[model samples]
Target: MAERDDLSRGLWAVVRAMWSEIGPAGKAVLVALAMSAVVALVLGVAIPKQVERHLIDAEIRKLSRIVGAMADAGVIPTGPAQADELNALDEAVRLNLLGSDTVRVKVWLVDGTILYSDEPALVGAKYSLSEERIDAFNGINSVDIPNLSLRENEFERGFPPLRELYVPVADDSGSIEAVFEVYHLAEPIETTVGNIQQLVWASISVGIGSLAIFTASLILVYGRSIANRRRLAEKLFGELVRSQAEERTRIIGSLHDDIGQTLYRIHYGIEDLRSRVDADNPVAGELAHIGELVNEVDGSLRAELRSLQYGTGEELALGSALDELAEVTEMETNLSVSVHVETDCELSPPTRIALYRAAREAMTNVRKHSLATTVEVRVQRQGDQVRLQVLDDGVGIIDDEGLGLTTTRERLEAIGGGLKVKPDRRGGTQFSAWVPASECEVET
Candidate 1:
């Protein structure tokens, strides 16, 4: 039972995967096929059976009219002279109406006696009338295949399969005088029914096939349109990321060249003034304070420049870059940080920048909002993909940290990567990111 349950689960999983891939139109096609199959089966069975029944019934009615005329004329065998008349009637029928299609003919009395039969041995034989034959005596006709298992059909073994008809012959008083039993060669009726069945099913097949082809074509066109939209979205996103990166580079260059050099000049002038001024002068103390402020601002600008320089350096592998990032996060946050690097793949500049910035922003958020004791950053490469996770044991995020997370996610997605932030089991925030490693060459 357990094995069966497991098998069932696996089967359902496969079904869900297939359904997800095929889209809504494909699902509709599946439903259409099932419905069409049922419709075809119902029509295939009912139409052919109905056609054959009508054909056999018309034959039974025609034969019954001839038998009724004979009974009204007292030509059906009730005595020796009528028996001779029945023989003469049979000769006329054989020359005119009875050919390859007629198998045998019999006239039965109301009391279940065979008054006249084409087969001489059956004449004057008393047999039990079937319930269906009794129904025929009440002025109804029935057509069916003969049941060979019945004792009455023992002599019928030498013949081919036959369709038997039981029809009533009524007199002027509306009382049934006799029952006409006609055995017909079923081949012609069966052949015609078979032909009709073939036509009906062939038309259904063509209709269903055309519908399926048309539906599939529409689905293909819809799928192509969706694919084109996705491609357009990705292209736009790529342009956005490129623009953002270029802007960051420009800002960093301005900060380092313009602001850093100006601060250095100011600090140097303050130092030269300090060397020339008296140690007890109040101006000397103010200059030293000013110099300290300048040095602090310069140090801050350098730190920001280092953070922005991720992925710009040609010598860095992704694993080594994340390791360096983890160390810096630990120094700034004063959190116990453990860094794990399991793979060494060299990524393209834009991809590496996306991953690196996402990691840096996550760590920064943890440092700013999470009042926790420890942080763990992991970087690993799996088949065709690389993953990075930053976890911090802190008070969980109670509110949304809007821009930091949203921008990080957008940047990652722009480069065909993803970011996820969730509360870990230990009530800490877990920031996870993954990107396709297939775009990167493995470092030797």
Candidate 2:
């Protein structure tokens, strides 16, 4: 049972993968082809059988009519016959019934005696009547392909498969007197059935071929439309990115020119006032403290400006960006930071941005939560994927992620990348992020 469940899940996963890979038009074509194949198979088997049955039924009816005409004309033998009577009966049988397709004929008495037969040696032979022959004595007409393996059918074995039919000959009182057994060639009916089946199969083939052509045309058109849409979306997304970068640059410039210069002037003014004041004056000490506060605020503002520049600027490589982040992190916290990045492939703008954000978020988490100091950041392109790892010698576990890390994770996931945080084997927290390195272009 477990194996069966696993097999079912495996098949389902394959189907889901196929479903995702094929677009809507391809899926429609696949379903149409499958349904058409089933239909053609059913008709291919069933139509031939139905046609053969109809042809055989017609042959049986014709045989019955021929036997009935002989009975009506008093040609069939009713009992034991003299030599002259047998000769007359044989003449009548040959003149009226014998043909290429009508190979043999026999008249049977109630006691299973061959009262009359075209085969001379079987004129007086006796055989046990089967249940079907007995039923014919009660006026039931039957038709079948005789099995030549039976002892009674030894003479007929030399012939090809023949249709065996039984027709009851009745007297004036409507009581059956003898049974007429007929053997007719089956080649005509078989030929007719074969021709009909060929025609049916040919028609099915043409229909399927036409459907395939139509489906191919539809797929081509749909594929072209999809490609066009993708190109348009990429163009729009590139424009949007450029516009956002320009807006961010504008904001950074405004803040630097307006707020930054004003704060700098305020700090300089405070320092000059402190220089002119008496050294032992209490007010001078207070002015010095105020200048220090202003300087700290200016430093924080400059750090924020650098961050904004990093996001908007396009000149820095991914490795350089991570190195700059590490330096800033080391400066702010009492931690030693090491960086290693080995990648030869160029990265897309979005991938570069996402990886940089992941590193920054991981560093922020380390600063806020982890206790120990030293940190190491590593980046490398492994096969098709580019991986980033930030290891800290701090505490090994984090109970929860802050909103910054969560947002970074979502951003990475949006670009077919992922982020994971776990405990390192060497007693530190490990932050890992990865994106497909082969996907060097943005996708809609």
Candidate 3:
């Protein structure tokens, strides 16, 4: 259960880290871009067809009106509007609409005769609108079918394609009069629509390409930024460890050169004094007893001296050493401190120094300024690095005016360690340091 919980926590942490990198700005942009793309797809593909159909309808109605006017004025048909007049109107319609090579317009009688046609040879031909033959026809209409005949005023292309219109003319009686035909070059409209489609596709492709590149760029920038920060952090940890090791070595050397020699001299003098004393005279008896006591005192002193292991300069065992330093410091300064140090692995000298100095600096700050009664030093090792924390339940820092922190920071930095002041999770200023073991291991 514990392992599972740890794994779940780790996965969630990774997810949170990823979310932090992408952020809200990126998500909003992606959503807006997606909506825009949907709109573009609809507009680019759908609008042109609608426009073309509307244009064709309008042109067809106008054709019917023009032809109807001619018929009403006795310009076409027999009786009041005779066949000669009808022929004249037909010729006029032909001349006007079919004059252009690109346009083919024709008029057909209900009997399927090509009454008027733009193509001369096709005039008077039989008309058969098998393509658009319908159950019922609208007044003014346009459709697309297959091959169109100019003479019969009938046209064909395809469904919603090259459009042709057939408009029916009506007299005062509202009777079906004649059919008027209008021609439109749908290829141009289709071509224009095609061009628009190509442009839209191109634009969409470019937009998607750009979006992909931009997204990739953002991810890359964040990734590199995080990587650089991690590198800097690691380097700091290494330096702290190395600096701590160096400080420990220096302190050990100091102990050996100063206190060690003093203890050695004291031991030898005690030995000589004991040898000189005899058991004969009364004064000698008293001196002999004092000399024996002195020998016991010398042995105790020698035992105390052994604590340093003369010039051993061995890496300090993490937990015990921190407790010892705290104990000695409390005795000297009258400051009450609780040291909580634990470690699972052996520590290098540099890492130990970094942790110790960081704690010492915090203690010094407490002693000089905090005037607090309780101080805490905690050190723990996790995996490859050691983390140390120092906290004081003293008066909070007064506007951060102290050099101990700066000096401690410098010392830790010298060996690639990190020092930072954070609001103690428990309500105080906490100084924390971390150093890597690899950096702390000094050459013997």
Candidate 4:
């Protein structure tokens, strides 16, 4: 029973998968084939029976015509006939109808009296009639397989199966005068039915086979087209990512080379001028403050530049990069920041960069929007995914996310990762991000 259940489930899964992958046209074709197969099966079984019925009907009509002709020729007696007359009737029946196929014949009166039969013993005998035989008196013809077990059919006992046909004989006034009954060997009719069934089944099989091949070909063509389109889309996405990375690297290089050095020189010039002035001079005080401001700006710029270079440099480990982010956030804002690295697995460069960006974005939001006094950054590997969580003790949950965070989420999702932000249990907001570790693992 368990194995049967498993097999049913497996079949259901395959059907579901196919349903999801195929288009409307493919589904329609499958439905049509299913309906056609059902119809074909029904016809395959029913047509053979109809053919046998028609064959029996043809035999009854032939026998009825022969009997009617004999009556018209004055070969049948209306009342009880003499021994000579009976002999003449029997010979006529044997010559006209009795053969290998037509095994028996009986002429009967409306009162259930057998007038003449090829078997001499049944001549002028009376027997009780069944409804089917009585129906012949009303001009209704029928065919059936006779029951040889009955007393009336004792002579036909041990005989092969036979088809019994009944025909009503009419006089000159269109009145049924007598009933003619004929029995034919069933083997010939059965053989004919078998041959016809073979032909019908063969035709049906050919049609179904052709339809199946057409449907399969259509599905194959459709599947290949979908696969090709998917491959093209993936290629385009990869190229777009590479181009963006290159552009970002170029911008980082320009900032570090030109703006960073210029800022450094301005800070030193201010410091030198302040040192040369008198200590009591108000001008020296202002110059000292300006130098302090320039130094702060330079420090902030250098920190951001380092963060931008994390994945591009030789040191692409996320653990160290996250620690640096915590330090910078703590220095820039008076927030107490902590870092926890709970996993040792190396992440690929893209994963490292995505995680770093998520962390940085969360910290920036915390500093700008949250009136938080403390923050915690944690990284861990769970199953096949690496997760990053940044929690800040701040004003409860915020409903709207900034544009930077939205972009960060898209970037993470592009690499089979996702981002979430919710209210932390510690009375602050928690920013969480996860990426598939299997796909983002560094090669050994």
Candidate 5:
């Protein structure tokens, strides 16, 4: 945790140092999508329109060639004969139109009268009475219809979109004889463009969806990894705290039990030696007893320090820490004391020491300042947390500057713990500390 915070702070400091700014991720996504849409539109519209234009132009040229071929061969009879006399042009038109689904060919005489047409009515009657037919009849070999807005001949048909090319075919005597025109329906080209657009959009959508899924997965994975690291760090810190407490307890026990006992033995030997040598060595015996008394006092001090810091690094049963506190308060103070512990989760060594200190401070304050008769303690495990309380039926400290209570709060917070103190329901004060159960467990 310490390293992570430091790294993060340094990186952010560098970013701030550079005065760099970043756009929002949402805007970036939108811009990327919009660019994709533009590309899709180009592919969908431009390519197909170019293809349809090439195909329509080719049809027009082919129709012109067949009409010229018939005019060259004189296969179209000079005057009306059997319908079969038109066979050469008819055959040419049918063959060319058959090869293309888009082309429709028709033939009309010089008077705007249809001679033969793919449409039955045009074969015998006048055409649409449009200027397209008039121009073709007046020796215009190539009269292309302009689009609707130009106040000119309609470019193509109504429902199917229209494009027409009129080619005049002259007789041997040079009189205008007929017009051969090819019509192309634009609707199919438009429909083809629409399909292309749908396909392009589908591809772009799929690509974006894939990118989103991949990015989301990456973020989720990183978040989960960070969470696991935090949990492990907390666990390690708990273990380190418990280990330090255990080591301290071991050292204190050694000074009190082993070193103190050896010193006492040497003191007794010296006292006996002095008594034997100088007879009536009252001071010597007295000095030996004083030395023993000093050792005893030292032992008591060792025990007190051990109680504050001792541990086996195991989960410390709540009853044990509270029992010791209750005993000390009852024996030293006039206040009647009671302690109750109901918990299934035990606290680790550091937490136990913290709780013991808090409870001890509260009771000590009660003894020194509170003119109260009764003190009550309750420790309970609520869900994942262990809660400890010390209450006194005495005059309670009103100010926040009370040294002991302030220290208790600070200690709890140091371990990611919580502490609170309030007036008891019956009269006096209540002090409480709560910490997580996982922190209490040593190896387990």
Candidate 6:
């Protein structure tokens, strides 16, 4: 039972993986196909058998009617035959046998004595009545398949499958006088059944085929719609990214050319004013203090502008950006952090920004959550792809790191990149990301 449960779990896991690959619409198509196949199989087996049984029933009725007609005409032998009666019996059997399309015939009395048969040796033979034969004497007509599995069917052996009909013959008073057992050539009836079966299955086959085609068309329509939607999404995302970058560039340009130059002029003007004043004058002291404040403000402004430009993917290489971030993290967290640029390659603006953000986030996580000390950031160009890794000798991440990791993943995926976080062999977390360099342009 445990093994069975394990098997079931394994199967369910496979099903789940398959479901994920195909998604909701594909799963619906798969379900529809499975149901259709089951329905077709049931109808294929059931309809043929029902039709074959109806044909056999018709044959039984025809045999019963023929025997009834012979009985009414006084053609059936009633007793031991005299010379004239025997001659009459031979004539009756000879005429009726040809019209009946039967291989053999037996007319049996109620006590199980054969009164007349087409075969001379079977005539006057007394054999025990079979249960099926007894049923016929009681007015229940029966039909059976050709293979004789019963003792009373011994005579039916050695022949290809034949239809055996046991029918009761009634007198003028409506009493069953004897049972007429007829063995007819089954090939014709079987051929008719086979033809009908073919027609039924052909119709079913056409229906199933039409269903399959319809289902396929439906899946194709849905699949194409999904593809179009995905393409539209990617186009929109790319446009948004470009729009954001342009806007950021505009802002940074304004700050640098307008606000930045204005601050520099203010600082220089204060310096010149201080230089012209006397050292002993109270006004000179005031000017010097003002100049020192202006200088400090200018320095802060330049730093802010640099950060803004980096965030906008301008004026910063990926390796230089990561190296700056590592240095800042080391100062702030008192952790040993190192950055290495192992490849000489340029990347598109979006790729650069994405990888920079991923590395920065990983470093931040290491500082905030991981308690261990040493950290290393590495960047390399591998074929058509660029790879980034942040390795730290810190206690690995716990479950509650929250939306930072999720946001980083989304950012990477938006630019056709991926991220992975795994435990390093040295008991730290390794954060890795990669993107196709071909999808990016040379970093400006």
lDDT of 3: 0.60
Taking all chains together, each candidate's TM-score versus the true structure is 0.55, 0.57, 0.40, 0.56, 0.39, 0.51
Deviation from native of the Cα of residue 422 in model 4, angstroms: 28
Indicate whether candidate 3 or candidate 4 has the larger TM-score. 4
Q: Tens digit of lDDT per residue, candidate 4, span 138-213?
A: 8899988898877667888766888888988888898888888888888999999999999999999999999999
Best prediction by lDDT: 4
Top candidate by TM-score: 2
lDDT by residue (tens digit), candidate 1, 335-433: 888878777666666666667777778777887889988988888876545788898889887576589789878766654467888899978898899
Model 5 Cα lDDT, one tens digit per residue, 1-444: 977887785665444322211113433554665686677667666766676667666655776677778778766554443677666657756765543444566666665566776554445655454677677777764535445553222323343556667777777676777777666665565577668666766876787678667655654465455435534544665676667767777867787678767767766766666666554667766766676776777667666765545323134455775676677667666768888987655455566666766677777777877798988888876544578887887777567547777777776665546788788878888878876554332211
Candidate 3 per-residue lDDT, tens place, 1-444, comes to 977887785665555445444435655665776787787778767766666666566665566666666667755552233456656876767654544323655555556555555555666677665434221123434555435444333333322334555666556776544555555666766776677678777887788778768875876676567546545654676675556557756766776677667756765665566567664647666656665765676566555455444222334566666676677667657778787766554555545655666766677677787767777888775444578887887667667646767877776655445687766666666778876543222211
Clashes of each: 0, 0, 25, 0, 5, 1
Every candidate's lDDT: 0.75, 0.79, 0.60, 0.80, 0.63, 0.75
Best of the two (2, 4) by lDDT: 4
Which candidate do you rate higher for lDDT, 4 or 5?
A: 4
Better of 1 and 2 by TM-score: 2
**Candidate 4: residue 411 lDDT (0-100):** 76
Model 2 segments more than 4 A misplaced: 1-22, 68-96, 109-111, 130-143, 167-179, 246-250, 253-258, 267-444
How far out, in Å, is residue 351 in model 6? 13
Clashing residue pairs found in predicted model 4: none
Q: Give the TM-score of candidate 4.
A: 0.56
The local lDDT score (0 to 100) that residue 14 gets in candidate 4 is: 54
